[model samples]
Target: MTTSDILRAALVGRLTENGTLTDAAWAKAATAVPRELFAGSYFVPIEGSTPTGYRTVHPADPGWLEGVYTDQTLITQLDGRTSPEDAGEQSVTGAPSSSSTLPSLVLDMWQRLGADAGHRVLEVGTGTGYSTALGAHRLGDRNITSIEYDPLVAARAASALRAAGYAPRLLTGDGLDGDPEGGPFDRLIATCSVRYLPMAWLRQVEPGGRILVTLSGWSYANALALLDVTGPGEATGRFLPGYTSFMIARPHDRPPRPVLALLPGEERASRIDPAKLDTWTGSWVAQLAAPSAERMGSGGNQILSDVATGSQARTVPDAAGGWTVVQRGPLRLWDRVETAIEAWQGAGEPQQDAFGITVSAAGQRVWLGSADGPGWDLPV
Candidate 1:
């Protein structure tokens, strides 16, 4: 077999053995699509960099092919413009704007989506077209429609898909808006996270269709949900088991902020340990409690800055054994977080799956245990 074929087979074997590639159709599609085509060049982070730096890799480099086939997300663009070719030999630093998502996650989510024969699918965020190729392979090119926000990224993905001899309807527009004209699709999957389920997606999908997406916020905690559309402008589902995250959709990302000026207003002993915010479930709870605040720091040194009301909360380890929190502005950020965390603790500190979400004309609400339980309204 050719080198690409051999590598692809090995990847499929590893995924199947680990129980990630459960669907035979997905396995076949994984084997057929060449991932290296989409990841001709990528970036790897430079270890131990203070601000985080990345160096470029190319096909000519040793282990490039192996790295491409490995089940890991490969950074393809930085700051929306700098590609591997642009970085050259030096380390470059910027926020990751696009990537070829880890193969295992892609395959697993596709299987979890339960897409079957003749189902029309709308894919949000066609990053490198690798997942798009797999979907096209199994469901036919005519049945898939993928949308990308970055025009440059979309153009590159289109080239790669064409080279692989598969073409689905590709659009260079905001995935958050979705393809309205191509409406009533059986399934819609977002590769990016959103602060809330977009109304456009709800209206575009037919009743009884499924919408799979990750809900995230300023704090960056993510919860994956698969909602069954009960009717127009409405859907409900419980959080899926396991932790999953994706970059927040650009439109839903927090706006730029000025340098924070810490203000001290009310001070009190924290009801719960401040270190809890560092844990996965705890961080998610804190986020649900203060959806408009951006979280920073970790452990007892946590800081929260409210985007809307300019409210701020900061915690520090107190000499008296527990943690102390200082709050300022109209919003009592720490109080909201403490109450939420206490509620979560009262329920035995359950994982994300214990939570459920509902999206309706009334608004998006995330609840612990059930719909009537203690819940927080998502800042839509």
Candidate 2:
């Protein structure tokens, strides 16, 4: 075996030992595939003499080839297209469209799925085909159906999978709808992040089946949940501690709106207690609780209010790096919130640790905490 092969083996071994891969099937899959073949020119390499930690696409170099197969990430596409040719030869922007997810994260999510050979799996987001290849290795190609939103990416991934000797049924379409033709799957795994669980996936999968997805809202964390499909259109599961991020897959090809433009004007120049503003509110909390809020800008100049209720206020920085808050109308809410945050911080700068969503027999609750104790709560 080559040095790259040895490194691949060690990476797979680490994943297996870390409880991410319980069955030997996944390990075998990881070992059998040459990750470099599916990777793009730019890949993160192992640390060493070739400036290994940097991203490079020098195909001729031995280090580059080795970097391709290592258990690190590779930038396959940027901004919905193949990376610029010049970028392949130089250090450039690192916006990633698809990649073989970090090994540990992949293994953890795959294990969470608990797929057996008999299982029929529908995988959303066929990026580098690495994870799809792993699924095929475990459940066989005939039983795997993978979807990719980008037609070009879907085609490239299909070709790569075939070249690697694994051919699952690949589809170029929105994964939100799923492949209706391959219905009643035993397991549905989404490698992409989603704002809300698609109802179509729930409708297509068999009752008591599992759906593992990276819930897109608040906590900014992934949840590996088992969906019973108990009712006609409802499924539920508690959140699990898994961290992963994927491109947002949508029906259209348009890019996301810039964050700065989305900020409300009232929030442009407002005073805020930095401590209160930094509380462990769930991801969606900001959007829901403070719809027109903006994180304080530099040198505090302007403050924003909803105008209708003025319940929330936003402050921006002034010429110097100082914050200001302005409040008006019915909602003198910002002042109270600022005070609460300052009070909490005065006690101590509490480090908020685990924040997660809970869905079970009782109901749904979102909780936040640090090493100390619970800090806040929100209902879903």
Candidate 3:
């Protein structure tokens, strides 16, 4: 077998062992797409290091192809601007803007989406064209429309797709808006996370079609939801089990806030441990409790600041055997979070699967247990 073939087989073997590729057509497509064509030189972030501090790996580098075949996400862009090719061997410092998502998650989501040969799919966030190629291969290239927001990234993905001999309609625009001219599609799949379901997606996708996306918020807590468009401007769905997250949609990202200034505030013994803010379930509940707050710090050092009102809460160890929380501004950030934590706990700490969503022209609302159960209006 050729090196690419062997690499592809090994990758598939790994994915199969982990239960990522259940559908045969998708597995074949995964083996067919040359991930290296899309990734090229990529960045590997140093763990617990500066966000932008990464080592660049080129095809010529020893074991680079092996790295490509590894079941891991590869960083492609930093700070929304720089690619590894732009920075070369240097370790730059910034947030990762784009990536080739881990293959297992990619295939898992695609499998759950259930788009088939007859279905025309609208795919959002065509980051590396890897997922796009899989979609194009499984369905027909003519049956797929992939939208990418970053012009440079879109152009690169286009080049990669052309090299791979597949051509899907690639649009350089916000995926949230979808493709107006090309839609009313059969399925809408988003690779990025949004705070709430977009009404545009509901309108663009035909009634009874599926919309798969990650529901995320300012806190970056996220869950994958599969919504079925029930009518014009309406859809309802439930969060699937398992942990899933994507980078927050660019437009839905919180606005830049002032650098943290730890100011003194109303101090009291904390009713709940600040450490809860760092756990997966706790973070999800805390985000629901204070939907507008951006969380920072970790464990007992947790800090939460309201993005809109400038209210802040900082936790410190109390000499009297518990934690002390200091609060400032009009909004009591900790109080809201504590209430949410209590609610989630009272409900037996249900998993994300117990949550569901309803979307309409009015807005989207996420609820726990049932449509008539405890819920919150997603900030649209």
Candidate 4:
């Protein structure tokens, strides 16, 4: 066997051991699919220190090619363009337009879906059609419906799937609407992260059907929720232990506005000790959770906020061995942040891990540790 084959076996082993895939069908699908064919010229290298980062590798390099195929993610499209050719010289800024999700996560999501040979599945964000191919392999192409927002990507994935002998119905449209023509699906899986669950998805699935999606909010982490449609317009689920980051689907090609634009300017200010800003305040939490927010720091100087509005903020160490928050906001949002810190400290310096996400019939809530007890607040 080739090195790629060996890596593929290892990945399958991990997936089976992790309980992400159990059936012989899943193993056959994993082994049959040629992962490198879907992966573009480059793949995003997985880093130990960071969740994701990009590293360019030539297609001819056997080691890199095997690594890309076996380890999981393949950066199919950078930014909004499908391949480097379409992106021209501007590819660096495009972000990840399409990718083959990590194998373990893909199996985990598929396992959560509990799909069978007879089930009808609607997969959102058909980037590269690798997952669609896997589903088609398990359930057959006639039972799968895949949607991709980008026409270019949709066309390529359609062609790729057909070439692979799995001709699932492929649609190029906004997946948020959940292909009405293909109604009443047995399972709906969103490969992308969404700020809110689309009502159409909830309405389209049969009662008691499962809808698996990644819900991102104003928090540092995103939650993978497995919700069951209990009623006409209700679904409930809690945070899954793992986290993932996916491109935000937008109607237009342009990216969403920056988060900093929402904050008041630094000039409109009240003075406060920067050391007192609580990182756990609702606003900061909200900012961290914002989809537009991106990390802009290298170690200590790093900042996290929207790049468009230029709302930059960071934390630095002081002589006293404490951290100071340095922020530039129009209304001295930093001052409010300091007040929140004081409130938290006055109550008690809460340790980090005490935070937990609570989901109820009404909505989701985030709780923080406090001296008296756990303090809870609603997510906006």
Q: For each candidate, how many residue pairs have backbone atoms clashing (under 3 Å)?
A: 0, 24, 1, 10
- On lDDT, the leading prediction is 1
Residue 216: error of model 2 in Å? 1.8
RMSD of 1: 0.9
lDDT of 1 by residue, 1-380 (tens): 99999999999999999999998999999999999999878999889996999988899999999999999999999987999998899899998989999999999989988889999999999999999999999999989999999998999999999999998999999988889888679899999899999999999888899999999999999989999999999999989988799999999999888999888789999999989899989999999999999999988899999998899999989898888899999999999999999999999999999999999998999999999999999988
What would the per-residue lDDT of candidate 2 be over residues 104-171, giving only the tens digit for each residue? 67766777788887889999999878889888987899999999987877887888898989989999
Across 1-380, the per-residue lDDT of candidate 4 in tens digits comes to 98768777777787777677677777789887767666656644446525454555556655666666565677767757547454343324446778778877776688778788788889999988888989998899889999999898888788878787888989999999998888788889988876667777877877777788765543233556677777755665544554455555554222444344333233322233342222333333333233344544432333445444455455555566555555663333334344544555564654333344443345544445422333333332
Q: Deviation in angstroms for 364 in model 1?
A: 0.7
What's model 3's overall lDDT?
0.88
Model 4, position 316: C-alpha lDDT score: 56
lDDT of 1 at 182: 82
Q: What tens-digit string does per-residue lDDT give for candidate 3 at 1-380?
A: 78877998999998988788889999999988888898888898777884437988988999888988999898898879989898988887777778999889989988998898889999999999999998998998999999999999999999999999899999999999988999889899899999887778888999989999998899999889999999988999999998988998899999999888989999988888888778777888788778899999898888999999999998988877689999999999898888777767778888889889999988778888899987778888
- TM-scores of the models, in the order given: 0.98, 0.72, 0.96, 0.71
The predicted structure with the larger TM-score, 1 or 3, is 1
- The predicted structure with the larger TM-score, 1 or 2, is 1
**Overall lDDT per candidate, in order of appearance:** 0.93, 0.61, 0.88, 0.63
